[model samples]
Target: MLKNFNWKDESGFTLVEMLIVLLVVSVLLLLTIPNIVKQSKSINDKGCDAFITMVQGQAQAYQLENNKVPSLQDLLAGGYLKGEQKKCPNGKDVQIDSSGKVTEVR
Candidate 1:
Protein backbone atom coordinates (compact mmCIF):
# COMPACT_ATOMS: atom_id res chain seq x y z
CA MET A 1 0.00 0.00 0.00
CA LEU A 2 2.88 2.39 0.70
CA LYS A 3 4.36 1.68 -2.66
CA ASN A 4 1.02 2.31 -4.40
CA PHE A 5 0.52 5.69 -2.72
CA ASN A 6 1.54 8.71 -4.81
CA TRP A 7 3.15 11.56 -2.85
CA LYS A 8 2.59 13.98 -5.76
CA ASP A 9 -1.21 13.48 -5.57
CA GLU A 10 -1.47 15.17 -2.20
CA SER A 11 -2.16 18.88 -2.09
CA GLY A 12 -1.74 21.25 0.86
CA PHE A 13 -1.11 24.90 1.55
CA THR A 14 2.55 25.93 1.42
CA LEU A 15 4.22 28.12 4.08
CA VAL A 16 4.05 31.16 1.84
CA GLU A 17 0.32 30.67 1.22
CA MET A 18 -0.37 30.42 4.95
CA LEU A 19 1.77 33.46 5.61
CA ILE A 20 -0.16 35.44 2.99
CA VAL A 21 -3.48 34.49 4.59
CA LEU A 22 -2.18 35.56 8.00
CA LEU A 23 -0.93 38.82 6.57
CA VAL A 24 -4.36 39.55 5.05
CA VAL A 25 -6.09 38.93 8.33
CA SER A 26 -3.61 41.11 10.22
CA VAL A 27 -4.07 43.97 7.75
CA LEU A 28 -7.85 43.75 8.04
CA LEU A 29 -7.64 43.87 11.81
CA LEU A 30 -5.36 46.91 11.72
CA LEU A 31 -7.80 48.73 9.45
CA THR A 32 -10.84 47.96 11.61
CA ILE A 33 -9.43 48.42 15.12
CA PRO A 34 -9.09 52.21 15.06
CA ASN A 35 -12.57 52.71 13.58
CA ILE A 36 -14.02 50.42 16.23
CA VAL A 37 -12.34 52.44 18.95
CA LYS A 38 -13.63 55.71 17.54
CA GLN A 39 -17.15 54.34 17.23
CA SER A 40 -17.02 53.13 20.83
CA LYS A 41 -16.09 56.62 22.01
CA SER A 42 -18.85 58.18 19.94
CA ILE A 43 -21.36 55.74 21.37
CA ASN A 44 -20.28 56.57 24.91
CA ASP A 45 -20.58 60.30 24.27
CA LYS A 46 -24.07 59.94 22.83
CA GLY A 47 -25.11 57.76 25.73
CA CYS A 48 -23.84 60.33 28.19
CA ASP A 49 -25.69 63.12 26.41
CA ALA A 50 -28.94 61.22 26.50
CA PHE A 51 -28.42 60.41 30.15
CA ILE A 52 -27.95 64.09 30.92
CA THR A 53 -31.16 64.93 29.09
CA MET A 54 -33.13 62.35 31.03
CA VAL A 55 -31.71 63.55 34.32
CA GLN A 56 -32.51 67.14 33.40
CA GLY A 57 -36.09 66.20 32.69
CA GLN A 58 -36.34 64.47 36.04
CA ALA A 59 -34.90 67.47 37.79
CA GLN A 60 -37.44 69.70 36.11
CA ALA A 61 -40.19 67.43 37.28
CA TYR A 62 -38.89 67.59 40.80
CA GLN A 63 -38.77 71.38 40.64
CA LEU A 64 -42.33 71.52 39.39
CA GLU A 65 -43.55 69.32 42.23
CA ASN A 66 -41.65 71.13 44.97
CA ASN A 67 -41.81 74.63 43.48
CA LYS A 68 -38.06 75.01 43.73
CA VAL A 69 -34.89 74.02 41.93
CA PRO A 70 -33.43 70.81 43.26
CA SER A 71 -29.84 69.83 43.87
CA LEU A 72 -28.45 66.48 42.83
CA GLN A 73 -28.73 65.20 46.34
CA ASP A 74 -32.30 66.43 46.56
CA LEU A 75 -33.20 64.58 43.38
CA LEU A 76 -31.72 61.42 44.81
CA ALA A 77 -33.39 61.84 48.19
CA GLY A 78 -36.77 62.76 46.77
CA GLY A 79 -36.82 59.58 44.65
CA TYR A 80 -36.74 61.55 41.41
CA LEU A 81 -33.63 59.60 40.46
CA LYS A 82 -32.11 56.40 41.78
CA GLY A 83 -28.76 56.32 43.51
CA GLU A 84 -27.12 54.50 40.65
CA GLN A 85 -28.37 57.18 38.28
CA LYS A 86 -26.34 59.89 39.98
CA LYS A 87 -23.63 59.34 37.41
CA CYS A 88 -23.72 59.32 33.65
CA PRO A 89 -23.37 56.03 31.80
CA ASN A 90 -19.74 56.90 31.02
CA GLY A 91 -18.91 57.10 34.71
CA LYS A 92 -19.05 60.89 34.83
CA ASP A 93 -20.87 62.54 37.71
CA VAL A 94 -23.85 64.72 36.88
CA GLN A 95 -24.50 67.97 38.69
CA ILE A 96 -27.65 70.00 39.06
CA ASP A 97 -27.18 73.76 39.16
CA SER A 98 -29.37 76.09 41.22
CA SER A 99 -31.47 76.53 38.09
CA GLY A 100 -32.04 72.78 37.95
CA LYS A 101 -29.88 72.43 34.84
CA VAL A 102 -28.04 69.12 34.69
CA THR A 103 -24.46 69.06 33.54
CA GLU A 104 -22.01 66.18 33.30
CA VAL A 105 -18.72 66.56 35.08
CA ARG A 106 -15.74 66.68 32.79
Candidate 2:
Protein backbone atom coordinates (compact mmCIF):
# COMPACT_ATOMS: atom_id res chain seq x y z
CA MET A 1 0.00 0.00 0.00
CA LEU A 2 1.30 3.50 -0.89
CA LYS A 3 1.82 5.86 2.04
CA ASN A 4 -0.65 8.86 2.03
CA PHE A 5 0.12 12.25 3.57
CA ASN A 6 -2.74 14.66 4.33
CA TRP A 7 -1.62 17.77 6.22
CA LYS A 8 -3.22 21.24 6.10
CA ASP A 9 -1.05 24.07 4.77
CA GLU A 10 -1.38 27.59 6.22
CA SER A 11 -1.78 30.38 3.74
CA GLY A 12 -0.91 34.04 4.20
CA PHE A 13 -0.33 37.11 2.03
CA THR A 14 3.28 37.75 0.94
CA LEU A 15 5.11 40.92 2.03
CA VAL A 16 5.21 42.36 -1.51
CA GLU A 17 1.49 41.73 -2.00
CA MET A 18 0.70 43.37 1.32
CA LEU A 19 2.89 46.36 0.48
CA ILE A 20 1.24 46.69 -2.97
CA VAL A 21 -2.22 46.67 -1.42
CA LEU A 22 -1.19 49.25 1.15
CA LEU A 23 0.26 51.51 -1.55
CA VAL A 24 -2.86 51.17 -3.71
CA VAL A 25 -5.10 52.00 -0.75
CA SER A 26 -2.99 55.01 0.14
CA VAL A 27 -3.09 56.32 -3.43
CA LEU A 28 -6.86 55.86 -3.59
CA LEU A 29 -7.27 57.70 -0.30
CA LEU A 30 -5.07 60.54 -1.54
CA LEU A 31 -7.21 60.82 -4.68
CA THR A 32 -10.52 60.73 -2.82
CA ILE A 33 -9.64 63.15 -0.01
CA PRO A 34 -9.20 66.18 -2.30
CA ASN A 35 -12.53 65.50 -4.03
CA ILE A 36 -14.24 65.25 -0.65
CA VAL A 37 -12.73 68.56 0.43
CA LYS A 38 -13.83 70.24 -2.81
CA GLN A 39 -17.34 68.89 -2.42
CA SER A 40 -17.49 70.18 1.14
CA LYS A 41 -16.36 73.64 0.05
CA SER A 42 -18.97 73.65 -2.71
CA ILE A 43 -21.69 72.81 -0.22
CA ASN A 44 -20.65 75.60 2.14
CA ASP A 45 -20.39 78.17 -0.65
CA LYS A 46 -23.83 77.21 -2.00
CA GLY A 47 -25.36 77.42 1.45
CA CYS A 48 -23.80 80.84 1.98
CA ASP A 49 -25.19 82.09 -1.30
CA ALA A 50 -28.68 80.82 -0.50
CA PHE A 51 -28.62 82.45 2.91
CA ILE A 52 -27.53 85.77 1.39
CA THR A 53 -30.31 85.59 -1.16
CA MET A 54 -32.94 84.93 1.49
CA VAL A 55 -31.72 87.84 3.60
CA GLN A 56 -31.55 90.27 0.67
CA GLY A 57 -35.00 89.23 -0.56
CA GLN A 58 -36.57 89.82 2.81
CA ALA A 59 -34.83 93.17 3.20
CA GLN A 60 -36.02 94.25 -0.24
CA ALA A 61 -39.58 93.21 0.55
CA TYR A 62 -39.53 95.18 3.79
CA GLN A 63 -38.14 98.22 2.01
CA LEU A 64 -40.81 98.03 -0.69
CA GLU A 65 -43.61 97.98 1.86
CA ASN A 66 -42.16 100.71 4.08
CA ASN A 67 -40.74 102.90 1.26
CA LYS A 68 -37.45 103.27 3.11
CA VAL A 69 -34.38 101.32 4.25
CA PRO A 70 -35.30 98.39 6.49
CA SER A 71 -33.46 97.80 9.71
CA LEU A 72 -32.51 94.37 11.04
CA GLN A 73 -35.09 94.70 13.79
CA ASP A 74 -37.73 95.65 11.29
CA LEU A 75 -37.12 92.52 9.25
CA LEU A 76 -37.24 90.41 12.41
CA ALA A 77 -40.49 92.03 13.55
CA GLY A 78 -42.16 91.95 10.13
CA GLY A 79 -42.24 88.12 9.96
CA TYR A 80 -40.39 88.14 6.64
CA LEU A 81 -38.04 85.61 8.15
CA LYS A 82 -38.69 82.73 10.52
CA GLY A 83 -36.21 83.66 13.25
CA GLU A 84 -36.88 86.58 15.55
CA GLN A 85 -33.22 87.48 15.07
CA LYS A 86 -31.55 87.94 11.70
CA LYS A 87 -28.82 85.41 10.91
CA CYS A 88 -27.23 84.19 7.70
CA PRO A 89 -28.32 80.59 8.58
CA ASN A 90 -24.88 79.19 7.74
CA GLY A 91 -22.81 80.16 10.70
CA LYS A 92 -22.66 83.74 9.44
CA ASP A 93 -24.49 87.07 9.55
CA VAL A 94 -25.58 89.56 6.89
CA GLN A 95 -23.44 92.69 7.13
CA ILE A 96 -25.03 95.87 5.85
CA ASP A 97 -23.51 99.03 7.26
CA SER A 98 -23.96 102.76 6.53
CA SER A 99 -22.47 101.99 3.12
CA GLY A 100 -24.45 99.88 0.64
CA LYS A 101 -21.83 97.13 0.43
CA VAL A 102 -23.06 93.84 1.92
CA THR A 103 -20.85 91.03 3.02
CA GLU A 104 -21.30 87.74 4.80
CA VAL A 105 -20.06 88.03 8.33
CA ARG A 106 -18.14 84.81 8.70
Candidate 3:
Protein backbone atom coordinates (compact mmCIF):
# COMPACT_ATOMS: atom_id res chain seq x y z
CA MET A 1 0.00 0.00 0.00
CA LEU A 2 2.82 2.44 0.83
CA LYS A 3 4.53 1.71 -2.49
CA ASN A 4 1.33 2.40 -4.42
CA PHE A 5 0.80 5.90 -2.83
CA ASN A 6 2.11 8.85 -4.77
CA TRP A 7 3.83 11.62 -2.72
CA LYS A 8 4.31 14.02 -5.65
CA ASP A 9 0.59 14.63 -6.29
CA GLU A 10 -0.18 16.90 -3.31
CA SER A 11 -2.31 19.92 -4.47
CA GLY A 12 -2.71 21.95 -1.27
CA PHE A 13 -0.53 24.16 0.89
CA THR A 14 1.56 22.63 3.67
CA LEU A 15 1.23 23.72 7.33
CA VAL A 16 4.44 25.73 7.08
CA GLU A 17 3.17 27.70 4.08
CA MET A 18 -0.07 28.56 5.81
CA LEU A 19 1.76 29.66 8.95
CA ILE A 20 4.09 31.87 6.87
CA VAL A 21 1.15 33.53 5.17
CA LEU A 22 -0.47 34.19 8.54
CA LEU A 23 2.78 35.63 9.90
CA VAL A 24 3.08 37.99 6.97
CA VAL A 25 -0.46 39.20 7.38
CA SER A 26 0.03 39.75 11.10
CA VAL A 27 3.20 41.72 10.49
CA LEU A 28 1.44 43.91 7.94
CA LEU A 29 -1.36 44.61 10.36
CA LEU A 30 1.11 45.49 13.11
CA LEU A 31 2.81 47.97 10.83
CA THR A 32 -0.43 49.62 9.70
CA ILE A 33 -2.40 49.87 12.92
CA PRO A 34 -0.16 52.46 14.59
CA ASN A 35 -0.08 54.52 11.44
CA ILE A 36 -3.85 54.49 11.28
CA VAL A 37 -4.12 55.66 14.88
CA LYS A 38 -1.65 58.48 14.34
CA GLN A 39 -3.48 59.61 11.23
CA SER A 40 -6.77 59.69 13.06
CA LYS A 41 -5.37 62.02 15.70
CA SER A 42 -3.89 64.27 13.04
CA ILE A 43 -7.16 64.43 11.18
CA ASN A 44 -9.03 65.35 14.31
CA ASP A 45 -6.56 68.10 15.11
CA LYS A 46 -6.84 69.56 11.62
CA GLY A 47 -10.60 69.41 11.75
CA CYS A 48 -10.62 71.29 15.02
CA ASP A 49 -8.30 73.94 13.64
CA ALA A 50 -10.54 74.44 10.65
CA PHE A 51 -13.55 74.73 12.90
CA ILE A 52 -11.82 77.44 14.91
CA THR A 53 -11.02 79.40 11.76
CA MET A 54 -14.60 79.23 10.56
CA VAL A 55 -15.88 80.41 13.91
CA GLN A 56 -13.40 83.26 13.87
CA GLY A 57 -14.66 84.35 10.48
CA GLN A 58 -18.21 84.26 11.69
CA ALA A 59 -17.25 86.30 14.73
CA GLN A 60 -15.71 88.92 12.47
CA ALA A 61 -18.83 89.01 10.35
CA TYR A 62 -20.93 89.43 13.42
CA GLN A 63 -18.74 92.30 14.58
CA LEU A 64 -19.01 94.00 11.21
CA GLU A 65 -22.79 93.77 11.19
CA ASN A 66 -23.37 94.62 14.83
CA ASN A 67 -20.44 97.01 15.33
CA LYS A 68 -19.35 95.17 18.47
CA VAL A 69 -17.43 92.11 19.50
CA PRO A 70 -19.63 89.06 19.83
CA SER A 71 -19.30 86.37 22.42
CA LEU A 72 -19.77 82.70 21.76
CA GLN A 73 -23.26 82.86 23.16
CA ASP A 74 -24.10 85.83 20.98
CA LEU A 75 -23.15 83.95 17.88
CA LEU A 76 -25.32 81.03 18.88
CA ALA A 77 -28.26 83.20 19.88
CA GLY A 78 -28.12 85.25 16.69
CA GLY A 79 -28.09 82.11 14.51
CA TYR A 80 -24.67 82.87 13.08
CA LEU A 81 -23.65 79.52 14.53
CA LYS A 82 -25.80 76.56 15.33
CA GLY A 83 -25.97 75.07 18.80
CA GLU A 84 -23.69 72.19 17.94
CA GLN A 85 -21.19 74.58 16.42
CA LYS A 86 -20.32 75.83 19.88
CA LYS A 87 -17.83 73.00 20.20
CA CYS A 88 -14.91 71.90 18.05
CA PRO A 89 -14.97 68.53 16.29
CA ASN A 90 -12.54 67.23 18.88
CA GLY A 91 -15.04 67.92 21.66
CA LYS A 92 -13.39 71.12 22.88
CA ASP A 93 -15.60 74.08 23.55
CA VAL A 94 -14.92 77.24 21.54
CA GLN A 95 -14.89 80.75 22.90
CA ILE A 96 -14.93 84.22 21.40
CA ASP A 97 -12.97 86.85 23.22
CA SER A 98 -13.86 90.51 23.69
CA SER A 99 -11.78 91.19 20.57
CA GLY A 100 -13.87 88.81 18.49
CA LYS A 101 -11.08 86.31 18.42
CA VAL A 102 -12.14 82.68 18.52
CA THR A 103 -10.21 80.13 20.57
CA GLU A 104 -10.57 76.66 21.96
CA VAL A 105 -11.51 76.35 25.60
CA ARG A 106 -8.20 74.83 26.45
* TM-score of candidate 1 against the unseen true structure: 0.81
- Model 2 lDDT tens row, 10-38: 46788999999999999999999999988
Model 2 whole-model lDDT (C-alpha atoms): 0.73
| Model 1: lowest-lDDT 10 consecutive positions | 82-91
Model 2 scores worst on lDDT over the 10 consecutive residues at: 94-103
Cα lDDT, all candidates: 0.88, 0.73, 0.88
lDDT of 2 at 31: 96
TM-scores for all predictions: 0.81, 0.58, 0.78
Native-referenced Cα lDDT, model 3: 0.88
Query: Can you rank all candidates by TM-score, best first?
Result: 1, 3, 2
lDDT of 2 at 55: 72
- Tell me how far the alpha carbon of residue 18 in candidate 2 is from the true structure, in angstroms, after superposition: 8.0
lDDT of 1: 0.88
Runs off by more than 4 Å, candidate 3 = 1-10
For residues 1-106, could you state the per-residue lDDT of candidate 1 as single tens digits?
3667688898999899999999999999999999999998889889999999998998889888999999878888999887667877678888988778889888
Quote the positional error of residue 101 for candidate 1 in Å: 0.6
